[model samples]
Target: MRIALSSYRSKPHSGGQGIYVRHLSRELAALGHDVTVFSGPPYPELDDARLVAGRATDRATGPASRQTSSAKRAGATASIEPMSIEPTSIERASVEPPNPGRLRLEKLASLDLYNDDDPFRHPDPRELRDRIDVVEYAGMLSGSFPEPRTFGMRLAREMRSRSREFDVLHDNQTLAPGLLDIARGGLPVVTTIHHPISADRRLEIEAATNPWRKYTKWRWYSFVPMQARVARASSRIITVSETSRDDIVREFGVDPERISIIPVGVDVETFTPDAGVAKNAPGIAVETSAPGVDVETFWPDGSARHRVPGRLTTITSANVPLKGLSVLIDALAFLPQDAWRELVVVGTPNRAVETQLEALGLSPRVRFVSGISDDDLAGLLASAAVHVVPSLYEGFSLPAVEAMACGTPVVATRVGALPQLVHGTDGETSAVTGSAGRVPAAHGGSAGPRAHATGEADTSADADGSDAGILVEPGDAHALAGGIVSLLESEETRTRFGRVGRRRAVTTYSWRAVAEATAAVYTEEIARC
Candidate 1:
């Protein structure tokens, strides 16, 4: 089947959405389907060999000036070489060559409104040169994210003229009016809502102290209403977890029957444990607000516990209130100075977080690191005594799962799919079932009841009495601190949990299985069409 997959923004390092597009497209192509990913900058980083081959072909066949223009636009130098190909059989002379089974990535150029140095800030002239669409640029200038709506417009316009080119159109959460336009034109459409954008808007509103900031957040999330409309109208909806599915239903008013749940998968190969790699000092690794790991402010006061050298790492992409970084920092205050040696955060912190760290006098104990490669991350995870995810809510916590895949124990909040993923159970009867006091349920209501009837709860704990990870109440710094302290204090428990987590990651979360299940959904949707 020929499939057109769309994502407004799909930079691999940008977030989970990019990772989803890259892995899923590769797996679908492996399944003998023609997969074309329509994305925006920064484009998905595909295999260098495939990209080089494609670019070489394009350059060799096009005019020299055209080649130069393409190379300049792509921000890369292009070199071309011709290779001879021999026909396998004389019979092939009379028939057309079959299409190669490889994933194709096409990035739709747009004004990259966000700066690399400061993503939320407006871009300078150098950044503006790459942007092509005028309407998209205007949206960005107007202080609203225009990618989803604008990408949908471009995709719809492109597909309307060539609608017959694809067997199915899969949208990666860009629920824009253009999607509804395509669906109305008799094309099969599937939109994956990782979670409702409404949840994000609400979180941002709650996080805002100033009335103007809250209003600004509201304006930024104004695209959500259009998303809800498109979601309800799509032929089918896919979500990462039951927690997110329920939130979608509540926030978007979509029928429960239309949404299907498919948990995200981790690349076990890339994230596997490396015992051969030396572990960092006995400290924890903290995911910072930045994309890479920054380790500047880790040394605490003159003491032996601080000198013993262990790190506590927290990985967070955004330093927002919903991430609970402040709560984690607050939790550190409750712990004894000797409880943990140093805190290593993967991303940079926001101003609010910085203030909290300063107020608590814990700035000396925290080190922030960013821009580290995935292999380096795996090594970091393996080195850490424990991995911590302090998010108040998540559609699905990829970091927690990735940490587990690296044979590292995780301590995360019981929100979204964290419990189900960490416990290695289905959504219905996971370890943390009840909604009360668990980070104010995603949509302000109980997640209804377990869809599937089960007699007993599946224990995440192994026979050795170690759980894959512990689930704590969201926003409860005390509980979070205690969980981390407990895990840090016991090597036996930590080792057992790590073993169980690694096994769960390997067996239950393979991309091949996820792709097959996703294909089944596609088949069903196509049949309905």
Candidate 2:
């Protein structure tokens, strides 16, 4: 079927939206469906090669007439192409290029907008530049975030003009007013809300220390109400996890029946274990605000593993309190200086985080690196003693799962979907309780003894039962530290968790399976329409 996937802004490296759009669109296309993605800056870096391959296969096997019929059935007509060019007229157009002077002028006009340090921010064709500008302009005008609403307007306008171009429209969390307009115009629309934005807004507001910051955060998330309304009105709603579905239903006031739980998939190919890479010693990797790592600092001998004694790796793109970077830092401080050597951070640190590190005397021990390629990240995960995700909240922790896919043991907070994703839970029970209770008491490992000692045997069973990884209470630095320390101290336990985690990640969260499941959702929604 012809599917139009939409995202207001798809920055693949930065957020889940971009990753979702890029992977899902590719997988859908791979399934013999026609998929076209509509996105705003920074646009997604799609696997155009895959789409090209699919088109080539189609051309090789199908006759022109049959191809046309198939295209019509899939809604892949002139209306859907960026600029429909007739096959017969293509040679004439190639021979007689557009006026060179006019072309140069157009290029010059867009040079500033297109040329930037970020490769992803490059301009698309001139025809779509104006539409992209609308989203950018709205963001500037609001002084906060207005892309969703503005992009919606632009999307609605385009879709209305080409209403028959797509059989179904799949929106990636951009529930703008224009979506409502398009839906009302009789388009079969399905929306995927990774989770409620209200959760982010609440976490930010609660984390705010000053009134101005809290107010600003409130104003920034003003678009959430519109999102909630749009989601409720949408024909179908898709979310990544049961926890997310519950949060959406409760926070957005949407009917539970309207929501479908489909967990996000990890690219196992890019995140697989590198048996050749040796694990690093006593140190930690912290990703601060800055991108890219200083090789000399983290890898003195140009080795995949760090030279430090006991190394820990943690990645946090944003230094927001919700990420619990500060909590992790505090946990690090609680450990003896000699216990863990260095902290390798993948992103840059904010002023507040820097101050906290300094106060804890961890400033010297932390190494910040950013902009590492996926392969490098996988290698880092494989080489680390343990991967820690200290987020206070998450819809789904992709980093944790990615680490698991790399055969790395993870120590994550039991918040949102972390418990279910890291420490596998009984699906039937989780659906009822909305919590992956404690790991079963029968399971062996450092977790069982710790749980019993803390008088948390009943609650702890939910966590200790799983051989995948360790889960600690959210915001509990001591508990997080304990889990990390426990894993670091025992190679046998860490190896076991890593092996189990990899198996779970591959079997349960493969992109192929996720794509098939998501396609089923689309088929069901379209049939209903």
Candidate 3:
């Protein structure tokens, strides 16, 4: 089957979209189908249809053709263990390489106004040669996100004249009217909405202090209504979590039957347990700068048999209010000064975060990293004391799963998919009602945490009622602090959670499983088309 995957922007180092496109395409190709990924600026570093490095005119190519010699295609079952904090791999079951699938990426050009090197960029007048280019610029000037709509237009134009080169069109959340145009030309379109942009808009608007800020937030998310319309019109939709599916039904008014619930996966290959971190010294991990380049990070681990003490890690593609970075900062402030030594954020730090850190005298403790290599990220997760996801909302929290895959326990807000991904105490999660519901602060050298509801396990990864991590009420700084403090204080609890989390991550969320399920969607959609 020939699959054409579309994404407006895929930045592999940071965003989930990039990671989604890269890994899913790879696994799909490994299943012996042909995949051609069409993407705009901040292009994806795909293992499937990958962008050619530093080439003006290199043809897109897939790994199977370049790498596979013989053997039938392997089945998409079992764990995709070890993750690079975001994505990684697992060993494929040795089987015949059926059909020998191929995956390659085709680049799509865009003005790229939001490039970090320069934001709100001024394009050359001559560059605005096409009507589409002018429209993209006009949208940006009006304070609206123009990438999705413009990129869809560009994609439609690219495919307009080409004889149906694909069996199905897989759209990665770029809900645009142009998709309707493509559908008119006889291509089955399958849309994946991680969560609605409306959710983000609501959070930002509510967080805004002034009328002007709220108005700006409204303007920025102006495309959301259009997205909802497109989603309603869409024949088939894919979402990551039950919460997301529910939101789509309530927010977009789309039929529940049109939506399929497929959870996001973690790469077990890049994010595995830290076996190499020698316990020669307490709270020490052999960090690597590159291959054969070792950098050592030492923290005071009193009884932590697994992780560095006071090293908390979190990842966010963007520094938005919805991510709850502010709450995480507040939580840190609530902690005793000696409780935590450092924080490692796996994303860029903006002015807002910097200002908050400075105001709280935490300027010297927090370390922000962007454009980190996969290995480095995995190593960092493995060494960290606790991985935190303090988001007020998440369609699906990828970082939490990735951290779990790295054998790192997570302390996340009890919202979105965190409850499903990270099992709290008592087999299933129960929301916090009041102060009594909050997780109590546990010291760093405490005993085992939570009950072990071990029974006959099911296929749904870590079905045993062992707690993977503690889930706190959303937007509560004190609760966040308590959860983190609890894990930090007890290595026995951390070790248990880490193992259980790993089991859950591996058995439940694997790229191979995701690709196979996605392919099934494509097949069903194409049949309808």
Best TM-score goes to which candidate?
Answer: 3
Candidate 1 has its poorest 10 consecutive residues by lDDT at 66-75
Model 1, 98-183: lDDT tens digits are: 33545566656666566465675544555554233666777766777888988888778778887788888999989999888888
Q: Estimate each model's TM-score.
A: 0.78, 0.76, 0.80
Model 2, span 1-529: residue lDDT tens: 7787888776544557767775676666666666667766655444422433333221111111111000011111111222222343101111111111100000011112322264224344453456546555445445456668777877787788876978888889999879889988888888988889898899999988999889988888888999988888887888877677778989999998877777777777657776224434422243443334343434444445432347788777666777888889999987776678677766667898888887776776777765554545666666677888988888777788888888888888766777677657444122211111111211222233433343121122234345567778777888778888777777777778888788778877766666677777778877888
Between candidates 1 and 3, which one is better according to lDDT?
A: 3
Error of 2 at 285 (Å): 12
Which residue runs does candidate 1 get wrong by more than 4 Å? 48-100, 117-134, 275-309, 426-466
Candidate 2: minimum summed lDDT over ten consecutive residues — where? Answer: 101-110
Error of 1 at 58 (Å): 22
The digit string of per-residue lDDT tens for model 3 on 375-404 reads 456666887889999898888788888788
